[model samples]
Target chain A: MREEKPGPLWLRLYALTVYLFLYTPIVVLVLFSFNDSRRNSSWEGFTTRWYVTLWHNELLMRALLNSLKVACLATFLSTVLGTMAALALSRYPFRGREAVGALAYLPMMVPEIVMGIALLTFFIKVGIQLSIVTVILAHVAFSVGYVTVTVRTRLAGMKGNLEEAAADLGATPWQTFWLVTFPRILPGIMSGALLAFTLSFDDFVITFFTAGIGATTLPLKIYSMLKFGVTPEVNAISTIMLGFTIGLLALWSRLESDPKSLGR
Target chain B: MKRFLAWALVLPFVLYNLTFVIFPLFTVLYQSMFTIDAEYNVSQQASLDNFKAAFSAANLEVMWRSARYALTTTAACLLLGYPLAYFIAVYGGRLRSQLLILVVLPFWTSYLIRTFAWTTLLQKEGVINAVLLKLHLISQPLQMLNTDFSVILGLTYGFLPFATLPIYVSLENQDRSLVEAAADLGATPVQAFWKVVFPLSLPGVISASLITFVPAMGDFVSAEILGSPETQMIGNLIQQQFLALFNWPMGSALSLVLMLLMVTSMALYMGLAGERDA
Candidate 1:
């Protein structure tokens, strides 16, 4: 007997069509990245020359490295701060708890342009020069909310029994968390860190306002390249970036699903 | 012990938010009110002159265009995204996570690159037109680029995943028995959906609208690459003021207005959502 499911065959076709629409432009870009000639719309033939050219582009490479550096620092700082905030929110009841929670969640709500300009104004008012440090600070500022939300969900799913049992066994509060609580929420922390890293890596608008002349990131570089004309070199760089993002997301989803990694 | 531990852990982030997010927003308001000359001389009293100029006929038209484009794009996303989200949540079975990830993969790519790809796909002599020509559908290529159509298309394409994810979450969490109960009571499939599924999934739709509209209203990338000058949005105007024209007061004023518009809409949505969820 055919399974008369609520979701029908028509739904599947519709879903696949939507997926095709979403993926086609990316496939086009990846295809043209290897074109033997410099036409964006035509396939002259296959060649890896664009990849080689991209490899040799010093300015873009520097930008790529800067993105990595910022992502790493921002991810680390945000994970630590956000994890602490999450632990606090879940562990205690206090006055103005709702207010604090709302305040912490504001970054997730505000538009990027607004957030970008607000920080830009703050930096200029305080006379702090824009540079790589400023970029990292801005990235961390916005990304902490992402981390807190992720970690808070993890902490919510957990039982207080484990930590209480640890304390009942004469373990110190710090030791109990380090041994029992921390390990259980580690997956959430890792996922949050991964999210922050990816967000910082691909950031353009916020960086546009906060970054100085010498501290351009990869997206900023690509934006400038688009100004001249779309070229195969940009295509090659985009392909590599697309691959990197996919790999990271795969790792993140893996951590998310595995209970053992979540200290089961 | 627990209360002390909690506050200690939370205080640093609160401080950081105040210094970074809150203070800067206040500065935007302050910056909007003052006029500065060539030598950086500051005006003492607050003035609405900057706001007045920003709301002048020319700039107000751009703001109106931006909001209208955002609304159209949000509607397009909902029309296209809701069905896909329903399909994935209902029929994806073991493939649910995989398919959801597919929706997110495009979102993970660089925004600039994503927009750049559309230029190739939609340009006058681009792939779509080339294919159409080869198919003998049209003699001349369609002028797809440098138009509002292309801008809306790019914005929708780039943002479909944002629309899908929230709706998918709500759909996935819904009790299937509600729909089944409706079906068992002699309701048609379309009736079951309209009466049961759509009402249940509305919170997701509301959130999807919030995220989509906020970013779409502030987007300049789609405008700069896909739209002509006549269709340029307030974002482009703000960018011009800050970057090209060096008119800081006007730019700040414009930013605050956009921010106010976004906040009002968000608050309205939240108030409605709170009542519904309650």
Candidate 2:
């Protein structure tokens, strides 16, 4: 074996710079959330008063709750539908399979603005009133794509004969899926669902277009608050939302510890 | 009967896509193919006038600028991210998963908040300027915010993780024996990297390009939050046409043209990509 030479210090320093580039903005956001001054530029003293202020802000709180509701509903529906889509692609030898898969994946591949405006036109044409329901529909439209991709990858990696083995054991088709297939695929499904929840929760463009009067999600709320100027309270809410996202990610990590699951 | 039953599972989703995806896309196409008149009424006389307007000199300039911005961001991400991905993949050894998790955990945060954070970092009194001043690097705080520089920096920062993960996967999965063989044949490490490692990692690089480029092209959040009107891209234009102008026909037309441009570029890239694999 060739003895490896010690690497140059520049490359290691470059890597350190890359990490700083990725991390510093977020670190700044989090740091300023505790800054006692109304302006976050200079630190006067540290306090969690922004957190207390966040607690009392009715509009931001309501928008956050609305976001959670939309995210939960979108995640649930997309998981079910996307699992079916993944299963239909993986388990069956159907014609036009590639075409259908492409169709399903197009939402994720298309630009967010295109996806947003196109849906806005469709809803307006069909006379569907813009509301939180419409927002959920929009979120589900894209979240389904993420779920299908994740679940489909997991399904592809599985041994295809497990269902048949269950059938050989005298289990009915439905029973086979529930007892054998479901358990095997549950980790993929859960991770895909968690991903769906996060994407839906973080969605801005689609929600902005589809949301009519009185259907503002958290991002829309943030955008408006930002129109005025950046403040410590915005940072506090953002830090809190980031905390929620990390919490979801932790839950997903727990479910995805199985090596068989695609650790995406 | 079995085949039919198999397809039955996909029926609901097919219906859902028809309502949301297919119908919405058709709406954009149809809206783009016609013109709206004085009374806000849709006439059945279809023409490419809206498309012509969409491709007007000014809009085309915006499109070109967006392409340039995306290209710059993609290049920046690749340059910055490739080494980190390499470090994590080759040097990480026992700490690979932990290092990867550290990279990915930041991605779970909201993109808007991250972009907004850049406004704080690049503004005249922001972190970078403040630090630069403290060091006596320059007599003045540089005008970093609301510039092309800030927008691109924000985009590169935002999408760096996307570029890193794919490249790391490619690097990690690369066959070490090929490099070993190259070394055994008396090739230097640099030559081995060029001849073996880079060629093998092209697929990941292409994917990284796709993910980074596509989003950067469509990104308005950074431009809106961190850029002046002079630095606006195609996405910001679409947003303005939709929200500010209330010009649905023009907005739809712009959207169609944007989609066309994206799809054409992607298809072209995929063709080249497929050729690369062969």
Candidate 3:
């Protein structure tokens, strides 16, 4: 490896500036979430009143519940389907495999608005009611591709020798899978499930189209609240969400960096 | 039995995608062939009218605006993201992953909240204007929000990570000895970058542009929250048709056109990139 050299000072400054630009808005929002003043125009004394108010807000609480429900169901469905697809594609040679792979990955390429409207039309045509169920279906449709890709990356990195060794040691196929393969791929499955949950939890556009009356998710609620006007409540809720998402990401990165700590 | 198990594992995924993804896309195509009436009734006879209406002068203007805004956003992201990715890739010796995590941390949050944060900053009575007023930069608050600038800024900000990650991947994969070889041959640092480093990183640039431009083209949320009626994009137009006007046929037509545009651009860009490789 070449000797390490610090980059030019200007490059470092430029990078710092870019980081500031990326972070300033979020920082400002978090700070104002604690402002005692109702108006976001000026800073006042700090208070957690908005956060307290958030818990009492029935609509916001319901939206949060709906978001969790949709995210959980969608994550479960997509994780199962995506893991199966990933495992099959990686380990099995089959006809139409490439075609199936392309079709499975197509959702990641399509625009959100197109998918939203198309699903809207499809549901109406099929006479399915637009509700939290529709939202979960839409979420799963888009997120399965992400789960598949994530798990497939982990699979690609893993060695197949362990499974072969288990089989050679007089283990049944199912036993080999449970004893060797499942433990090895568990991190991949967890990370993929985490990704699916995030995608479902954070989705806005597709949910906007599919969610009928009384099925508002957090993003939809946030969008309407923003349109209704700025309030410290939005800020407080956003900060909480930011914390949740970052915590998940930190967990994901830990799992990614030290997969062996999963006690395999 | 092994083949059966493999097919069984794959079948459910394939079937689900067929139901949710392929069928919906076909529905969009089918719906686009007809027209909607004043009472929001779909016409029995399919015609080319919706497609024609989609290409009308006013609609064409929205399409043009979408392309212009998306292109501008892509260019801005490239300009901002390339240098940062370069810095992290080339100079981030020990802290590469940490720096990259910082870059991705913002992206991992909700996009709507991030865009909403801008409203707090760019509103007339907001933080940015307040800062400017205190500094005596202007006599009154500038009309910053609900304009093309705000919309594009939001787009660029939201997609910067998308641009940076790809370019960083491309840059990080480069062979360091090639740069040393270029220097050994009396090439200046600038020459080495332009001839060796930049050329090799074109794949990342191409992918970055593809990912950025395509999503920006279809994005309505940024334009919806940050822009005015005058600054509406194709995405907003589609949203209006579907949600507000109940014009599903027209919305479907517009969506098909948008998809066609994305596919065409992706094909043309890949072809160009391929030629560069050749």
Candidate 4:
């Protein structure tokens, strides 16, 4: 390998500027969360009052709980279904395989608004109420694609010999899966679950359409708060949500180190 | 038996998607063909009225504005993201993963919060104005919020990572010897980049453009938060029709139009890119 040459000074400066631009909003959001004043125009003395208020705000708290509930359920369902689909695709060469793959990918390709309203219309037509159940269904539908992609990638990378060797040692199929296959794909499944949870937790547009009265999630609550106007309480909640998402992503990166996987 | 088991394993996923994804989209298409009455009851009779209304002058203006904003956002993201991606791929040796993480970190956060952060910055008495005023740069605060500029800026900011990561992947995967070979052939650095580096990254550029453009086209959050009613996009229009106006049929028609446009543009872009490769 050749020794890497340094980039031009101008290029370095330009990259730095882009980084600053990317981070400034996040930094500002975090900073003003602790500001004493209600207005975000200027920084006042530091205070944790907004955080305190956020803790006591019943609607916001309910929304947070609802987000967690929806994310957990959606993540579990999508992960299982996606992993199964990935396994079936990788393990068997069946007719209509390509069609099933395309069907799985359809949710990701369609715009969120299209899917949101379509689901809304479908639910109303089917006589199903718009509630957290609908939100979970929508999330699982969208997230199945991500999980399938991730697990399929992992399956593609695995050596088929390992599972064969396990079976050759007098192990049953279920035993081979449990002792050999499951462990290898666990990281992929976990990462997919993490991705699903984050997507569900932070979703706004889909949740906005699917959520009925009293079924607000954090993003929906944040949207309403944002529409109401700027406040330090909103900043505090946003900061917490940001922290949670970053923490999840950090965990995900540890499981799936390749940045390319994120693109899929 | 194994094939049957595989089919069984895949059944739930297939059923879920058929029930939720495919069926609902078909429902949207079906619903788009019908009409609604003044009492918000969808009529049994199917007609093309919703499609016509979707193409009305006012609706077309919103669609055109959406396309223009999406295009502009795509262009801006390319301009800003390409260089940063290029820098990271070429110059970032040890810190490459860290830098990539920074690029994606903001993306992982809730987009609503990120746009709201911009509201705090771009408001009339917001941080930017306060700083500018403090420095005596301007006599009065510029009306930065609730404008075309803010909405577009917000879109670009929200989608920059989408543009960057793909471009970076393409650049990183390129064989360095190609550039070296170009250099050895007595080509200037600029010539080498344009002829070798940039051409090789076309796939990434195309992917970046599609991902960014499609989302930006469908995005209403930035416009809803940062733009006024005058600057609303097709997304906001669809949202209003369903949620505010109680016109599900119109919303369905508008959504189909948006999807049709996206598919058509994607096909056109891929066709052009394929021709270029050929």
Q: Encode model 1's per-residue lDDT on A58-116: one tens digit a residue.
A: 99999999999999999999999899998888878877677777876898777777778
Cα deviation of A200, candidate 3, in Å? 0.7
lDDT of each: 0.87, 0.87, 0.92, 0.91
Question: Which has the greatest lDDT?
Answer: 3
Q: What are the candidates' interface root-mean-square deviations?
A: 1.7, 1.7, 0.8, 0.9
lDDT accuracy of residue B207 in candidate 1 = 83
Q: All models, DockQ values?
A: 0.69, 0.64, 0.85, 0.79
Candidate 4 chain B: worst 10 consecutive residues by lDDT? B1-10
Q: Candidates' TM-scores? A: 0.95, 0.95, 0.98, 0.97
Q: CAPRI band of model 3?
A: high
Report the number of the highest-TM-score candidate.
3
- TM-score for chain B of each model, two decimals: 0.92, 0.94, 0.97, 0.97
On residues B1-278, what C-alpha lDDT tens digit does candidate 1 reach at each position? 77888899999888988888888888888899997677767788889988888889998889888888898999999988999999888888778888888998889778878988888888877899999999999999999988889888888987889999999999988998998899999999899998999889998999888878888988888888788898898778887877787777778899889878878877887898889778
Error of 1 at B102 (Å): 1.3
How well is each residue in A87-198 modelled by candidate 4, as lDDT tens digits?
9888888878898888778888899999999999999999999888999999998999889988888888877798889888989989988888887788888888999999
Reproduced native contacts, each prediction: 0.76, 0.64, 0.81, 0.79
Off by over 4 Å in 2: A1-7, A259-264, B38-44, B267-278
Model 4: docking quality category: medium
